[model samples]
Target: MKLLFVADPLASFKIAKDTTFAMMREAQQRGHALAVCTPQGLSWQQGLRVQARVQDIALTGQADDWFSAQPERLAALADFDAVLMRKDPPFDSEYFYATHLLEQAEREGARVFNRPRALRDHPEKLAVMEFPQLIGPTLVTRSSADIRAFHAQHQDIILKPLDGMGGMGIFRVKADGLNLGSIIETLNRDGAQSVMVQKFLPEIAQGDKRVLIIGGQAVPYCLARIPQGNEVRGNLAAGGLGVAQPLSARDQEIANAIGPVLQQRGLLLAGVDVIGGCVTEINVTSPTCFQEITQQTGCNVASLFADALEAAVRGA
Candidate 1:
């Protein structure tokens, strides 16, 4: 089988800790040919959809080193058996363009994980607003007055870029906090990007959980990320450490409620974040954490994820 992975770059991959690399390894072990591309690589040539040059990939011990696949322009999506849209995000215009291109792949009979059409229909964070009862005090706004309105209701709030990934551009602002103006300005200076302001959960001083819902079933476990000193954000990218943990009734309930929703959205694998038993966010685009959990808990997360993904794509 030929598979193309649309991702950030070719050479800078941490195989031991990257979910995409892990999945790639699993696919390779199963004897599949692989191609790698980036968002900038996608282009439409007449009726043929082509991607920038792709190299072979293999896990390597050396940092920023990957065994390169023979570089070549990728053919139309119909020529490949599957495509994994594993690019990281800030959800910029380029990312949206890639989704449109991938949708073309979906039309030509290439199976795309999580379904390209659904991706276009769903922006990970906003999609979950449909289930408000499960989440925290989330306010999506570009107006300072609206943010202040939410701030009046909650003394402490978590501020994050609405279109970011891996916990980037996350900040915690307490009541009458310092420089709310500066913070909002910093987030919007690039343009008028809406930010998501959520009620800060003091419970995060303990941890936040990243739960992976696969094919409508919660993995038997999820990761609880303990924040570092003086940090309110529990995102792994923000220096939080992941520990193996079991699901509480609260956790199970959250997963059970969300799993079917994810399935119906055609998001076969999703990472849902929770703090203090309240669903904080839903991460659909390239959600990761399986590597950390598997290492800590001795679970075959790679195999489990791969099996489920292949099953979803193959209908087997």
Candidate 2:
């Protein structure tokens, strides 16, 4: 099968930890022809179909020189058997426009995983609100007063911007409300942008577990990213140490409840973040940890994803 990955620049990938690179490696090993295009390379003229300046890539085993790419050439997205939207997030206006292009490509018979509309519909932080039963006390608001009230009620809380990734712009306020006002100003931009406020889960010291779900099924192992000294965020990007462990019973329960819903929404791949027993976030855009989990647990995540992608393409 011919596969196209709409992702970040090949030159920018940290091959050692890049989940997209792992997926590409597995797909290549299975003899699938692979093409890659950055979001910027996608274009659509008024009368023409969506096309990308895609490079066909060959993976080298070397970590430093991971891939060799052929010269890029324009091709319609529909030319590929499946297109993986694996771009990392800030999910800004440009990302929104790119999704619109992919949605158009979908109409022209290009199979897109985690459907474009679904990606737009389920912003990572906001998506967890859909399953309130699984989450801790949470509030999405822009008003400083509202945040203050939530802080008063919850005592210890986490405040973060809705669009943040890699734990950027996250703030924790204890019962004393240290810098709460400033954090609200920073995160909400003084009532212009909505921010998420949740009651702090003390269990974060254990780890913030990332459970990967593929094709409506949960991978048995999860990557538990443990926050290091003096850090409250357990995101690997936030300097946390990742350890792979078998999913606990609560993890399985949460995955079982959310997996099928995600599948129905066309999110073929997802990462559900859990801290303690509370569901914290649902990561659909570029959910990672493939290398961390596989290396620690021997779980072959990339191979599983490739298998799922192949099945999805054939069925599509």
Candidate 3:
């Protein structure tokens, strides 16, 4: 099968922990043709089917110089057996536009995983609202009053921008309410933008578990990203220490309950951020930690992902 991965630049990839690279490697081991392109490479000319400036890539077993690419050429997305959208987020206007173009390609009978329409509908931070029973007390608002009200009731709360990634723009307000007003103003842009506020779960000390679900099934292990000293964010990008472990009963329960729904929604792969057994985010776009789980737990996440991709392509 020819698999085209839409993601960040190959030159900048860290093979040690890059999930996309892991997927590519596993697929290559299985003798699948692998190609790559960035979101900028995607194009939709007037009557042409959505296409990309794609490069066929070969994975060399090297540390720094891992992948060597063929010269770029234009190809319709439908030409690939499967198109994996593995672009990391700030899910900004450019990413939004890329999804629309991918959606157009899907209309031309391109097999895109984690379907384009589902990607647009499920913004990582906001997607958790769909499963209130699985998440903690949450509120989305643009008004300072609304945030203050939520803080007053919860006492401890977390505030973050809707489009933030890598734990950026996240603020925790304690019972003392220090800098509460400033945080609200900065996050909401003085009521011009909306922000997500949730009751701070004290179980963050244990770690924020990233439970991966592939093809409507849960991976038995999870990477628990534990926050470093004086840090409230448990994201590895935010300097957290990742410790992979088997899924707890509660984690499995949450995965079992939510996995099938996401699969039905066309999100073949997903990562659910759970702290204290309460879901915080539903990561549909480029959910990661494949290498971390593999290194720590001996679970070959990329292999499982490749298997799912093959099955999906066969079914399609």
- Show how many residue pairs clash in every candidate, following the order shown: 3, 0, 0
What is the C-alpha lDDT profile of model 1 across 120-216, one tens digit per residue? 7778778769779898778888888787788788978878877777677888888887778788888766347788889988888768898898887
Q: Where does candidate 3 stray beyond 4 Å?
A: none
Query: On residues 231-276, what C-alpha lDDT tens digit does candidate 2 reach at each position?
Result: 9999999999999999999999999999999988899999999999
lDDT of 2: 0.93
Q: What value of lDDT does candidate 1 attain over all alpha carbons?
A: 0.78
Give the TM-score (vs. native) of candidate 2: 0.99
How far off is model 2, as Cα RMSD? Answer: 0.8
lDDT for 225 (candidate 3): 94
Per residue, candidate 3 scores C-alpha lDDT tens digits across 221-315 of 99999999999999999999999999999999999999999998889999999999999999999999999999987889999988888888888
